[model samples]
Structure formats: C-alpha cells, structure tokens
Target: MEKPTRLALLKEIAEFLNEETETYDMMQGALKFLIDGSDFTTGWIFFIDNEGNHGLVSDTNLPGALVKNNCQYMQEGTCWCVQAYSNEKLTKASNIINCSRINLATKAHYQETDGITHHATVPLRSGREQFGLLNVATPYTKSYSEEDLELLESVAFQIGSAIKRIWLTDQEKEAARINERNRLARDLHDSVNQMLFSVKLTAHAAKAMSKEEMSKNAFNTIETTSQQAVNEMRALIWQLKPIGLEHGLINALSSYSEMMKLNLNVQVDGLINVPSLIEENVYRILQEAINNVKKHAHTDEIYLKLSQQQNYLNIEFEDNGSGFNINHNTEHVSHGLNNMRQRVKMINGKINIQSSYEQGTKINLIIPIKVD
Candidate 1:
C-alpha cells in the first residue's frame, strides 16, 4: 500500500471540523470521511449519552449484509468507548475472534461467519474529556497494523476538539438565560408591584368611609382614609419614579419627599441604611411603607428613623396625626401591604404598620443584613 500524505490528512481533518455547524452533521461527516476513502467493510460511529449507553451517532454505507442482518448490532454497552477514554490508551484489535483485550460485547456483536473481525479504535478525546470512539472494522479474520492504529488516533483527536467546542457554546447560552431572569425578577418586585398596591389602598379607604357623611367623626374617617390613599400614591410614585435609585435609596426617598411637600405640606422623615444585594427592592418596599403614614395618618409632622442592628436593619417612618388599626382598619391605605410582604420575604425580613383613625400612622421595617 502507498503511504498516505500527512499534510493531506491534516488538511482533510481540519475541513471536517470547520465545515459543519450542526452537531449531527459534524458526526456524520467525520464518520464517512474515515470509512469511504478506505476499504473498511463495516464501521459506525459510537455515541455515548449522559447515562453511559452507547448507540450509533451515524453510520455510512458499509456492507449491507453485515449490519442489516444486524451482524454488528448498532447499539451496545458503552464500555469500549469508556475504557478507551478512561485509560488514555489506543485500542487495536487484530481479530475479533482471537482478541482478548476487548470485552464480550464487542466479540458477541462483531464475531461473524468469518470467525472474527479486525478493528482499531482511539478515544475521541480532547484535553481530559472524552466524547466517544471513532472505529473502523472489516469482517475479515485479520489483524490491524500499528500504522493503521496511528492514523486513526489522529482522526480521533480532531473529532474530540470539535466536540469540546460544541459543548462550550451550549454552556455559554445557558448562562445568558440565567442572567436575564435575575434582572427581570428585580424589576417586577420593585416597580410593577408597588404601583398596584397604592391603587388598592386608596380604593378600599374611599369605599369604607363616606364622601357624603358631614359629621366630625364621619368626616374624620373619610379624611384619614383619603389621606392613606395619597400616601400610597407617594409610595408608588417613588417606586416608579426613577432608574437612578442606584444613586442610593436615601437620595431617591429624600427627593420624592420634597416633591410631595409642595402639594400636601406633609414632611417626610426618612432613615435608610445602604442596601444589601442591589438595594432596589428594599428601597421600593421602604417607600411603600412610608407613604402609608403620609396618606392615612394625615400628619404634618412625620418622623423618619434609620438605624442598623446586628444582622438586621431598621427603617421607621412615623406620623403624629390619625393612626388606624394596623390589623383591623380596611379604611386606610393598606394597598401596598402585600407588595411589601413580597419584597421583605425575598431578603427574609418583615414590615410593621401601627396606627388607627386618629392616633396617627407609624411604619416600621426590620430587614436582614444581606450584604452584596
């Protein structure tokens, strides 16, 4: 036999790896490239799945009688490929009948009427990772030469590199998907939920107390309820107001309080600590709790307290006007109550609202210290 040109072989293998974009196409092309140019009577590409079972990734035109009679069955245990990869050794079986190195599966499948087969296989391995085996066999009772073994090893190397590149690309795509989910999760908790809470609190308070009632007690109930609605509006507005909340929650809250004062003359006292894990949702929850005081308490003077406790942080916004029952009053704005519930739950903290129709509203928050 004439010696095969090394340059031509390398060029042919490079084209095989670079030419195919899809995975199965690459497998089929690589398998056929090895079998067609030579006179291998029967051969197939062995594919190993995650569960370690082996099957034919693809098989080109081999002798019909050999494979169709299921002469060499298409599926078998993955042990051959596994051992090749695991040992990092080249496997050469001269005659399947007399070959003792290979396990029974190979003999049971490939041992034909000719008594045995000859094949050489090298693990398609790149770095320390092995994808499967590249193999070629003939139904003749003869052994493969050392030269044949060396050539197939080169082919296996090319196949392994291609498998690694394909695997890497898939991992990158999966990582991108996870990052997108994290950003969307933050947005929903901060912006969308806060606005809806304000709407609910205001509507409920308005329904419970009458616009028609003129008596002082009746009018006070309406006033307190209406004010609670306005405060929730402040909370929602603060939450929806800025993309600049990353400037720090303190600045955003202070700016919002200034804007509300011109219209309602309600002073906002805010106490805030730097947030853990991006602070965006924490800011929104605090804003919702404070506005509850402004809207429902109807106080001209609201006190803000910000302090940190070991392993926990506290934010207090209190008003000295009309306080409603934290548990019982459906009349004042509790619209954002549920929204705050969600935000705090993410960080494993809790919110407290204390007040009644005339006692004034005080909002307190206790959140865990989760430093990003």
Candidate 2:
C-alpha cells in the first residue's frame, strides 16, 4: 500500500471505531477484518502497558480467552513484539521468526490458535506509551508483505482508541457500586440500630418499676415484655449488620443464657463450630427459637446445643416448660419462625419442631455443609 493509502486506512478506522459504547465490540470486529482483508490467517491483539506487560484484548473465532488483571499476551517465542515495543519500531519483523510458532506467550492461554504456524505481530506505540498490538498469522510458510504491516498499524490506532473507552466505562461502574454500598451502611447505622436501642431501654425500665411486686401474674407480664424487647433488638442487630463471626454463635448464645435462667429459671448450654456463612444462619435460627420459648412455650428450663456431626451441623433447643400443640396454626409465629425458615432455605438447611401440649417444644435445625 502507498503512504497516502495507508494514512487513509487509519483515518477510516478512527471514524468507524469511535463510538462511546461500541468500543469493545468494535475492537473485536476490527481484528477479524485485518486477517480477512490483509495478508494473514490468524490474528491476535495485545496491548503493552506502562509496566511492559502484555494485555490480550480480543481475538477472532477462538474458544479460550486469556484472563488478565492488567496485561497482554506475547505470540513469538523470542517475542518480536516485546522488542518492537521496547525499540518503538514503526514496522519490522524477521522472515525466519514469522515462519515459526510464537511461543513467546508467558503462559499457554485458552485462546491458543492451535492451527497457526507463521505469524507477524506489530507492537502498537505512541511516544513513551505502548498502547496495544495487532498481528496476522497463517498456517502455511507464505511470507507477509510490508503492505500488511501498514494495514495492521492502521487497525491498531482504531482498536487502541476503543480499548481506552472500555477501560473508562468499567472504572465508572465500579465507582458507582462502591458508593451504593457505603450509603447502605450509613442508613443501617443511623436509623435502624438506634431505634432498637431506644425501644430496649424503655422496656427494661418498665420491667423494673412495675407494681407487680411478688404477684405471679404482674411479675410474669413485666418479664415477658422486657424479654420481647430484647429479642426484637437481637433480630434488628442481625439484620442491620451481620457480624462476620468475630462474635461466634457461642458469644451470641451466652448473651441469652441469663434470660433463660431468669425467665424459665433453666440451665442452658451452647456448643458451635462451622464455616462462617452457614454458621451465621444457625445463630439466627437459634435466636428465633429462644424467642419462641419465652413468648408461648412457658418452659421453666431450656437447653440449646450446637455441634457438628458427620455430614451436617446439628442444633438442638429443648424446653422443659409447658409444651404446646405442634399442629396448631403457626401463623402467629410467622415473624420469627418464617424468617428462620427463609434463611435456612438460603443455606440449604431443615428445621423440625417436635412438641404437643405436654411434650414441650424442641426445635431441631440441621444444616448441610456440602450443598450443590
């Protein structure tokens, strides 16, 4: 190709690949056009960045793509493109090197055009910056022309412009996601958790100053109201901010031990060991089970145990207090129990309640570790 014609091709590329959103796909189609219209069979595009690393951008009709945090791939075994990149060569290559496979890639990538044999890759450079690369390869020993190099450079200018646009768009989306998470955290702390604390304080005061004195009826009412407030706060804490197991299930359970002792006047023990995500769900389920014990079961003594068995984590919560009919409608228990069921479903677990009038309510939560 003549100099005037070569310059015109670059200008044409700029016009076609300049769109804001279509840059990535434009880079993809441009590589295909270079091989099909120019003197090459297989084409690979790469960008040599500030740190002298290869960043594979796009390819034509290939299955495996090279994954990169920020780099490209080298095709020549001795890496002609690296040298061209370092030297900032306008257009150059070895006749012998083009006839051989470019094992110059740092590692074997999924996008290896296994059928490619002879190849030519041009390092894309603009002053001190190495933007990207463009190349054409063939299975036969035929030599590529100088005309091909000029055309590849033309494609490089357009493809490089498109790549820069893609990078900017990605950066914008990531920044937006970070901002959203920050806003969510602030809302939870400022509104939800603070209100729960106020409710807890008021309930505790009512329990203490109530004129129940020693009357079982008035005393029981005061105790139940305070306990209900505490349970509500526990659920709110779990929702507002899920503690990342820094405070394990045992710590969460221990906080409730005094309540079991005071309300039912029973002895309770808790054991726990499991992975973070699954175990967190277990903590929530047990908390709800304890709330149920206080609200309706009227049990004097309660037992809560958590430990890992063969294939699953077992949670046993038993109460010696007045048991209720398990067959009775669970609609009234929807808030806590339903929430537990929904959470258990997410972690692939099961909850079994065994109780009737005198039998006492025992909640068994089994969470499977190995889920498909």
Candidate 3:
C-alpha cells in the first residue's frame, strides 16, 4: 500500500469507529476497513474479555465454510500469538509467529498451500493494557512489508482506544440504570408505601368500630386492597436491590409469589446453595413465570416443586386454570414463554411448558448447577 493510501485507510477506520457506539459494531467496521485497505483476503479480531477469556470478537471477508472452520478451531484450540500477547512478549505487529487457525484452514482446503496461510498479528492496546489481537492473512505472493506492519500497528491502536471507549460507555449506561432504579425505589418507599400503610391501619380500625353492615364491608375492602398494594410496593423495592436473593432461591421465589397474591406451595428436597449468578437467573425465571400465571392463568394458586437430583436442579411450576390450545399459534404463547426460555438458556438451563384447552399449564425447568 502507498503512504497516502495507508494514511487514508487509518483516517477512514477512525471515522468508522467514531460513528459506532457499540463495541461489536466498531470491531466489525474496523476489521472490514483493515481487510479492504490491504492485500489480505480475510481477517478476524480476537478479544480477551474482562474475565480473561479469549474469543473471536469480529470477522470479515471470509467464505462461509472458512469462517465456520476458523471460528470453531479458534474457540476450541489455542493460538501462539494470543498466548504471547497475554505474556507481554508480542506487543507490536510481527510476522514471526504464525496462526494455528490459518493452519487448520489450510488443511481443510487443498488450495491453501504451505505459504498461503501465513498471517501477521498486532496487539490491540491502549496505554499498557492490551485488549486483543488483530489478524490479517494473505497469500504468499502478497506478503506484508514493514510498512504494512506499521500501518496495522497504528490501526490496532485506534481500535484498542475505540474498544475502551465503548466499554466506558456501557459502564455509564449501567450506572444510570442502577441510579434510576434507586430513585424509583426511594420514591415508592417514601410516598406511596407510607400512604398505603396509613390507609390499611385506618381501614382496620374503621372495620372494627363500624356498626352498619355496608360501612363495615367498605372498610374491610379498603383494608384488604391497601395491604395488597403495600405488599406489592415492598416487593418492587426489594427487586431493585434483590436483597434476599443472596440468602436462598426458595425464599426469593416464595416472597415473589406472595407479592403476586398467589397461594404458593414450595417443596424442596436435597437442595444446595448455588452461585449468586445462577440464583439471579433462577429468580428472574421464577418472576417471569409468576407474571405469566397472573396475566393468563386466571388462578390465584400455584404449586412449586424444587429438587436437586443428580447434577441438576429441577423446578416445576403448575397452575390449574383456563389454558389455551398448544397446536395453534397463539399470541399469548410467544411473549412470556420466549422470555422465560431465554432466561433459562442464559444459565445453561432447559424449560418445557405443556398446556391445552381447559387442561391447565405446567412448566418444568432443569438447570445444571455447580455445588460447592
């Protein structure tokens, strides 16, 4: 590549990063720009997450078969470049170490001969912290020069800075979400919750003192509704903090059921404490399940059974209510069921729902849990 062209490519990549607010989008744009500017046929970016796990972040300009094979190899196997980069031995752009994914790709395709699979890698870094590796591969005839290496290094720096900026933006958004939740929690506790409490107390006294039948019935209704609202507000406040979830999953599910005005029966056998992350997912799944029941079940009673058998945790939520046909595509079947399914899958769990006209509904979830 010429001097002017290299500078133009770098500027274009920077502009592309400027337009992107998401990390993955920036990565895809950067990879496309790098491959388009150079003689490289295809390229991919490998990023190390905050947990120090190495994985492919973005890829471009590769055939479907080649991309699949390379992605699988990279996911399952190790790379010398990434290992050396982690150890601080491979910071700058270098052609000294080759790529194992490229070697695998060559073996899969006979056309990729001995020298055609070679690639150059540079560390994507900002200051002293390296985020990932940028890889560009071309055939033997179009081998990279020193200038190409310098240009890739400069591109890596720009991408690294963009990645950091995207990360910071995510952190800010999460902080904002937490702050808003706290504000809502405080407002509910200070105003609505207190008023509900007062109403409940006044209604209770009025119910006891009233002699007329109509006045006593009115007071009784007021007391019951006010109590229900207060309970719901309390649950909402706890959801913002998720305080009791750290204690146990069963307790959290029971409390959530009470808030929904459901007569919940909890049965547990051989249960053990799981990680907080898994517990959080479990709580979310249960909450969604209860909401689905309240919205569609038309019943105020639920049976919940949780058991730890073998290496998995099994939970069953059953309700005897008006059920819909499962054969036809029903609108109610998609939203809550899909949300529950996604929550289960996020924690490597499985969920099954069985429902039919007037037969009620039963949902069973089997989640693999690690016991300490």
TM-scores, in order shown? 0.42, 0.42, 0.63
What are the RMSDs of all candidates, in order?
19.8, 17.5, 8.7
Residue 110 miss distance in model 1 (angstroms)? 11
Ten residues in sequence with the least summed lDDT for candidate 3? 62-71
Candidate 1 lDDT: 0.58
- Compute the lDDT of residue 215 as modeled in candidate 2: 58
Local distance difference test values of all predictions, in order: 0.58, 0.57, 0.76
Which candidate number would show the highest TM-score if scored against the true structure? 3
lDDT of 3 by residue, 137-158 (tens): 7756345789878988899999
User: lDDT score, residue 299, model 1?
Assistant: 53
Which stretches in model 2 have alpha-carbon errors above 4 Å? 1-16, 19-26, 36-39, 49-57, 61-78, 87-117, 125-128, 139-142, 176-184, 203-372
Q: Model 2, range 77-192, lDDT digits (tens) per residue?
A: 32656556655663533233642224433235525545554566665544333456666666554566777655665676556656656545644553464456446655765676
TM-score attained by model 3: 0.63
